[model samples]
Target: MTAHYTSQTDTDRAATETATAPAQRDRQARGIGSIDRLAGRRILVTGGAGFIGSNFARWLAPHAHVTILDDFRSGSRDNINDIDDISVIDGDIRDAGLVANAVRDQDVVVHMAAMAGVQRTLDNPVDTLEVNVEGTRTVLEAAVEASVDRVLFTSTSEMYGDLFEPPYREDGPIAPKTNYAVAKAVNERYVKSYCEAAGIPYTILRYFNVYGPNQDGSTDGYVVPKFVRRALADDSIPVYGSGEQTRDFTYIDDALDATIRSLGPAGRNETFNVGTGYECSIRRLAEFAADVVGRGHIIHTEDPRPYRVERRCADITKARGVLGYAPRTPLPDGIAKVAAAMKRSDRQRAREV
Candidate 1:
C-alpha cells in the first residue's frame, strides 16, 4: 500500500494519483479545443467570489466576459480583486434591483450564492430559505428580465441527505436533513420551476464533495480541508461519528469543467451529478492529510451528530452521458495539491509573523 493510500489496497491504481495539476492547467490554458465556446459572451455569475464561484471566475475569465456579483457575504476579494478584465460588482443577490443590474445584458447567469455550510444552515434556517430559495428566485427572475439565454443552478448532494445507497441520482426524492440542504433543494426546485414555466433555460448541478485549493475550509463543513488545516496545525484530526461516513469526493477542476459544460448548447435544464464517484470515509481522508504533513498521529473520532450520518456517493451517469464529465484528478493527487497550497499559505502567514 502507498504511504498516502490506506492499508486496504485496491487493484485500480486507476484512481487519479500521479496526474500533474499545472500540466492540466497548461493544457486548458492553451485551449481545450471546445472550452472557448462561451468566449466573448457576457456571463454573470452570482457568488463568483466564493470558493466554487471564484474557481469558476478564474476558469472562465480567459474564455468568457465574466461578470462577478458578490456582496462579500462569504466571498473573498482575493477571488476577483486581481481580474481587471472581469467586472466585479459588490452587491447582494437578495436585492432584486442589484440582481437585476448584475444579470443585465448577460448571455448566461450562474447562481451560486447562498448561506453556505451545514452548521450555519442549521443555526439559521430562515436565512438559508430566504437567501438560497428566495435569492435563486430573484436571480432567475433577473435572468428573464435581462433576456439571458440560459442559467445554471448550483445544488448539493446534501439535498440527498441520509441516502444509504451509493451513486445518488437526479430522480430521487428530496430528503434534506440540514437547513443548508433544504435551501439547496429549494434552489433546485425554483430553477426547475422557472425553466419549465417561464421557458427560461436552466441546468442544475448537484455537486458531491468538491475539494481544491481556493476552498475555505473554515467556511465549509467539508471533511478533507477541515482535516488538512487541523492536521497541518499539528492538532488532532477530529472525526465526528466514528469517521464511518463516506463521501464521493470530486476535484474542483472536474466540477468547474462540468459547470462550463452546462453552459454549452448540450447543457440546458439537464441536472447532472458532478463527482469522482470514489467513496472515501472521513477516517481515510484524515489519514491522507496527516500522512501528507508527515504527522505521527491517529484519527480522533467523536460522537456522530444526529443531523449528519450516512454516505454520499454520486451516480454520475447523467454527467457522463450529457456533459461528457469524467473526473481526471485522483483523490490522492487532489488532496496533495490542497496540502501543498495550505503549506504555502502557512509559510506566507509565518513570514508575516
Candidate 2:
C-alpha cells in the first residue's frame, strides 16, 4: 500500500509552498494530462467562481476562451478574482436573458450553477428547485437556442440516496431524498430532454464526494473540508450519525479531467460516474484530517439533516472505459493537500490582516 503522507524534507516544503499548493504539487507528481482538444473553443461555466467550477475554469482558461457566469451566492471572488484572460460575468443563472447572453456564441456550456448542500437545500427547497432545476432549464434552453456543440450537466451521487449498494453505477435508479439531490435529478432529465428535442449533444457527470482547494468549509457541506477546518483550528471534529457512512471522494483535478473529457467526441451524449470508486468512512475521514493537524478530539452527534445517506461509492468503470478517466488522488493524499491549502490560506489571511 502507498503511504498516506509522503515524507518531505523542510527544503521540499519551502520550495513547494513558494511555487505551488500541495494539491497542485500532488497533481504534477502524478503527471496527469489535460484534454488539449478544447483549445480555441469558447466555453461558459455556470457558477464558474465556485469551488469546482472555478478550478475547472482556471484549468481551461489557457486552452479555451473561458467565461464565468456566477452570482457569487456560494461562490467566492477570491477563487477566480485574480485569474487573467477569463471574462467574469456577475449574474444569475435563473435569468434566462443573462444565461442567453452568456451562452451566445459559446462552443460548450458546463452547467454547474446550483443551490448545493443538503441542509442548505432543506432550508430552501423552493430556491433549490428553482435555481438548480429551473435554472438548468434556462441554461439548456439557451444552449439549444445558441446551437452549442456540447454541454455538460453536473449531477450528484446524492441522487442515489440510501441505495445501500456498494458502488452506484451510472445506470442505477436514483431516489433523491433531499431538495438538492431532487433538483439535480430533475436537471439531468431536463438536459437530456432538451438536447434530444433540439438535436443538441449533452453529457451528464454524476460526481461523488469532490474535495479540494477553493472549497469553503464554512459553506460547503462536505465532511472532508468541515473536518479539516475544525481540526486545523484545534476544534472538536463533529461526526454526524455513527460516522461510519462512507463516500467515494474524487479529487478536484480528477473531476476536472473527467469533465473536460466529456466535452470531447468520446463521451458525447453519455452519462458517466466521476469518482475514485474507493469507500472511506466519515470516521476515518475525520481521523485523517485530525492527524493532519495533530488533533485527537472528536464529537459525535445525531444527524439533524432531513436526509442522510448511509453510504455512497461510485462505479467508475464506464468513465474509465469510455473517457479514460482514472482517479489518481487517494483519500489520504487529497485530504493532506486540503490541509496544506487551508493552512496556506490561513497564513495569507494573517499576513493580509
Candidate 3:
C-alpha cells in the first residue's frame, strides 16, 4: 500500500476547518497525522448510536459537527455517550419528514440505520423491507432533496447471498437468500437509481462481517458475538454446520477508516467492498475467539444458520485502487480487540456491585 501521507498545507487547512467547526476540528485534532479529511466536517450517521455508527461517531466527534439518528430499533444510547457534543435524533428511518429534517444542514450523510439482522428479518419480513428498502429510499431521496454533498450507502455483503463465488466483487449479481439480504439489495437499487436520476453522488459500501466493541444481541446467529457471549459465560461455543462455512470479518475501526475516506475525493456513483480479503470459517473463528479469551471447551452443534450454504469474502482491488484503502487490522488482532472489550464490559458490570 502507498504510504498514507498529507502535506503541511493539508494539516493547516484541516486545523483551520476544525477551529471554525468545533466537532469537525476535534476529529482532525484527534487523528492529527491520520485520517485528516474526515475531521472537522458536518456528518450525519443514521443509526449513529449503533455498533458501527457509534464507533464512527466516536472516531469523528469533537473534530466534526456530528449528528446521529437512531430509532432505537437495534441501537443503544450508551454506545455514543463518549461523544457528548454530537446531535442525537431519536427517530425512525422510515419517517420521511423526520429523516428530511435530519438530512437538512449536513455535509455528508452516512446512512447506517435499517431493519437489521437475519433473525429479525425472518421474524418480521415486512418491517425489514420497510426499513432496509424503503428507509434507504427515504434517505437517498432526502439527500437529493437536501442537496447534500455526498452520501455513503452502507450496503451489505448479504446482498450477494449464497453466491458460490469467492471474494465477491461489487458487480457480482445473485439472489439474496434471506429477507434481510433481499431488502438490502432493494435498498441498493433505490440508492443507485436516486444517484443516477437526481445527479446525487454516493458510495455503496458492501461491508463484510464487521465485528468489534459494543456489538450486542442485535444480530442473532452472528458468529462473533454469539461465540463471544458463550465464551464469556464459560459455555461451549456453538458450531453450525461442519464448521467450514467462511466469512471475511473486518474490524470496526478499519471499516470506519474506509468510511471516512469515502466522504472526500473517492469515486462517486460507485460501489466497493469493505472487507479484509482473508476468510475464516465460523467454527475456526469461534475457536480463535475462545483462545483469545483464554476459554474453550466448545461443543459442536448442527448448522442452525438460517441462510442457505455458501462461502463469502471480498475482492478489495477497487477499494485499494480508487479509495487508497485496505483492511489494515488483521483478523486475529481484531477478534482479540473485541475479546478485550468484552472483558472490560464484564469488569465494568462487576464494579456496579
Q: For model 1, which pairs clash?
A: 16-330, 167-314, 167-315
Per residue, candidate 3 scores C-alpha lDDT tens digits across 1-353 of 11112222334433432342553343344324335665677889998888888988887775789999998877887887778789999998889999999999898898999877767778898888788888888888889998887788898888777655777777777667888887778877888788778777888898999987668732374668778777767778877667777788888767776776666666577888999887787777777767655566677777655555558888899888887776665665555556656666779999997
Model 2 misplaced regions, further than 4 Å? 1-34
Reference-based lDDT, each prediction: 0.76, 0.82, 0.75
What would the per-residue lDDT of candidate 1 be over residues 1-353, giving only the tens digit for each residue? 11134422222222323345754565375325446888888888889898899888887888889899988978899767766579888887889998888888898898888888766666777887888888888898888777778888888888777754766778876677887887787778788877777788888898898889757777345667877787767888777657767888888888888887777777877888888777788778877777665553555665645566468888898887877776777776677677667777778999999
Q: How do the predictions measure up, each by TM-score?
A: 0.90, 0.92, 0.87
Candidate 3 — which residues are off by over 4 angstroms?
Answer: 1-35, 217-221
TM-score of 3: 0.87
Q: Write the per-residue lDDT of candidate 2 for residues 138-209, one digit (tens) a residue.
A: 999999999999889999888898855768888878888787888888888898999999898899999888
Rate residue 111 of model 2 by lDDT.
90
Candidate 2, residue 179: CA error in Å?
1.3
**Clashing pairs in model 2, backbone N/Cα/C closer than 3 A:** none
Clashes of 2: 0
Q: Model 1 — which ten-residue stretch has the worst lDDT? A: 7-16
The 10-residue segment of model 2 with minimum total lDDT is 1-10
